[model samples]
Target: VQGSFKADIKLEDFVNNSAAVVQTINTWVEDRTNNLIQNLLSQNDVTRDTRLIIINCIYFKGTWRKQFEERSTNENADFHEASGNVSKVKLMFTKEKYLYGENKDLRVQIAHLPYKSDNTHVQFVFTVILPEKGVSLDSVEQKLSSKPQLLQQILNDGYTRTEELLLYLPKFKMEASFELSDVLKKLGMVNAFSDSAADFTGIVSKKDDPAGLYVSKVIHKAFIDVNEKGSEAAATTAIRLTKRRRLASDIKLVEFKVDRPFIFMIRESHNNITFFSGKFLSVPLSYYKRALRKIDVIFLDELGSEAAAATAVIMATKSISFRPKPSPIEFKADRPFLFYIRETRQNLTLFTGKFLTPTNFS
Candidate 1:
């Protein structure tokens, strides 16, 4: 079961010592989260003007039904980025029977992994929804939100059957912080943040004073660490007068490699109510190294200074088809080769080199 804590504190007592208030609140958060969250609020965030601070935190720790083998994890696995850049990542590997399926209409892949349970009746499944290589997460979310039934189908038993699954999930740790004032305003809760228009008489003693209290800022922080065993995640939301608030694929063996951007959800298997959902984007830097190419150009610098130096030089050229063609013949360069730069019209060689290796060239 997930544990959550909620509390409200007055800022008047610690008006002069904001640091102490921050430290106290952070300590409470750390204690509630098993020290997973150290500093939920900073000294700079708490001030004399901050009258009421409302805080909420949720912590979850669970073990996987089938734990991955630590030795099978590859430290350097290719993770494809949306920008077409491939980077290395610590990819956890496992081959076991898992609830898996694919949707041709949505062009998405789905996989379900249940958390360990002693009762054997209550099941909490973590489902991953991955769009095709070119498909975006935004599109998937939009489609799901518009047509809620589609989501039910994706999670239903008919869509996913037991299969021998080859899974490659990256070991990742992510911490995210956000200011949600603007988001709430955009969501049509405009009056909540406006100092003049807001009406929160029930919350604080602002009887007829329209300018008395209005949400100034809403801050939120979340963290998740996933590894061989399972996951530990914590999230905290605070409102300072503020209030406002807050892949795949497949084949025969059913290979499911989450080496790219995808969406995930933790749901109660019985009712299918999603408790937590998020998108995983951008792999760790250590996961993949970028393919780099270097170009070295040798230009005739003296040609500009000396007007008479090879003024009308011509270069020999070979034209190849820029469009479709059959398989081209392969030219292997295992042995030494000759390279020449010559003035085509004058039939005079300007430079010649014999290449045996990169370091040994003449």
Candidate 2:
């Protein structure tokens, strides 16, 4: 049976000597997974602010019952992209009897690639689902959403007979890391990420300390490689959960060329639960670049009304001088310019002047 594991460490200790701790954890993880993963946590990831750190690692190495011949692999196959572009990819070719089926309703072709089974009844299989041309994996996924049993039905009993199938699958490698805090929150996991709203008192019990711990980050990393020999896969998930309440059947020799966007999964045969599933849109998961952009936007508009425009400019000013301090005054001029000197308290006009262009001054 699987069980949960937890560990408690002082952030101060790590903060004092973060290099040692980071190196220790990274080395431990690397050795645990046979060096498939390195640098599990960076120096910045384990900082003084981090209250607690939790890590989970899983590793697997399996051999295919029938491996693809290296010499037969083709490097000139065109992989059709959803964007109507085509790229050349190395397709591993194999001719073997695979469990396969075609769902007329779903409009998809399913094939099963079984790994070498051990003494136990449980086995591991890589299932590939390929949609027909002019169709999309998204549509097939939508159909699966409605009919969740489609995968199992197709895998378990959909294929009646095993026949010689010519399979062409791309040889690729994938490594992905996801920050799932916001994604979890959007799925109704609110309190776990909320510092004030979370309740993980059971995780740590110290009445004197009232930091109100909550989960700050949940990081997941995965790696998978498929070659002529077999598949080597490993993944590590670090909760950093903090004291806070952390949170196919192949019928005939029908050609199933995976020269396009398709989905695949590494699942156990017993329960048919997916251990790792992903869409292979292209090769080298890091083929796409990461970008950060900063943009500045300034709004422009015409005031339209002279009174409003003048009022806006006056209100926006930092300084304004008034003669009597509290007295109210009104002055409106449409044409050029005008000024008047008067005895304000006695209401007597002493002088008046009007000026237009520079010609008037000249």
Candidate 3:
């Protein structure tokens, strides 16, 4: 059985070190990763303890508003980096009001869209450098560094409100978990995680006793989605610990420049339904649609599932077979048939009556 969720501290040193205590923890957890999870658990805290150890973990997910169909991504595309190297990357494209710019001299159009905010708060910006008749990204970043706003000037004046844009991005998602004890030690605060280290006066100090300020578990999870129209990223980082007491503080910002292909997903926390799904597999739409039709909607993975459907009906989850041999008309067009869809965690009502009357399905 899953236990109740709570943040309990010894409460003795909770007042003094509250400020630094929270800041240190935030830095420790946030510095571990540079991804999209930060956007999810932006304003969060991890509590410490003496006897009971609290472990907090979160799952973050997201997807693009306007999907870049799988087949749109093709090979023979150039991906330029800050190091003056161009890799062969599969570019995904779409025509929309995207963040775009064109460097006439370099002959490239770069569109940048920040990814969704998650726990680790990472922004995935992509620049599609459409090289001119003979230009390439190889000389672009270098020229920008020398001239500074060469790219900026283009971005400022080159931003056009075009509805249809040829967009190309690789879909991807990253999952990582790290235990940050030694990492914290490297960040300059050493006494906090030791047995003989003195003075936790800021957080809970019991008569000069050094039994406080030992971090047990620092778990951070992140997720991000970026495609056509804008991007979304989110995450939840929990510091489940013991021998401690501290108050939480402000959050920091981190950016992840995504210039390659990656996979991503959008998961519903409350209902666990994946409303919109995107893959960077470069497969046909019909393949995914047909596969999706056979898979259970409630719990779908990259593979498949034998998930069970709901039984009790009180809303829109009804089947022609679920009725009966001339079932009683407890719910007519005046009332309506009510069934439940476990996947979306919603109570849907199928009705054919007055809007006013259909709403009173108590």
Q: Point to the candidate with the largest TM-score.
A: 2
Q: Tell how far residue 111 is off in model 2, in angstroms.
A: 1.1
On lDDT, the leading prediction is 1
TM values, all candidates: 0.66, 0.68, 0.34
Candidate 3 positional error at 343, Å: 28
lDDT of 3 at 67: 49
Give the lDDT of residue 123 in candidate 3: 26
Error of 1 at 106 (Å): 2.2
TM-score of candidate 3 relative to the true fold: 0.34
Each prediction's total of clashing residue pairs, residues at least 3 apart in sequence or on different chains, is: 6, 8, 57
Q: What is the lDDT of residue 322 in candidate 2?
A: 22
Clash-forming residue pairs, model 2: 99-248, 99-249, 99-250, 100-249, 100-250, 101-249, 213-244, 214-244
Quick one: RMSD of model 2? Answer: 32.2
lDDT of 1 by residue, 103-218 (tens): 66566666666657565445655566666567665666676667656766666655565655667665554444456778878989787676667666675655544336666666
The parts of candidate 3 lying over 4 Å away from their true place are 1-60, 75-91, 101-165, 207-210, 223-362
Collision pairs in model 1: 87-287, 87-288, 88-287, 88-288, 89-287, 130-247
In candidate 3, what are the lDDT values of residues 16-81, reduced to their tens digit? 454554454344333432222222121123222332223232222223334455555443455433
lDDT per residue (tens digit) for residues 234-348 in model 2: 5222211111111112212247676666665555655555554556554332323321210100000010000000000000000112222121111111111111111122222
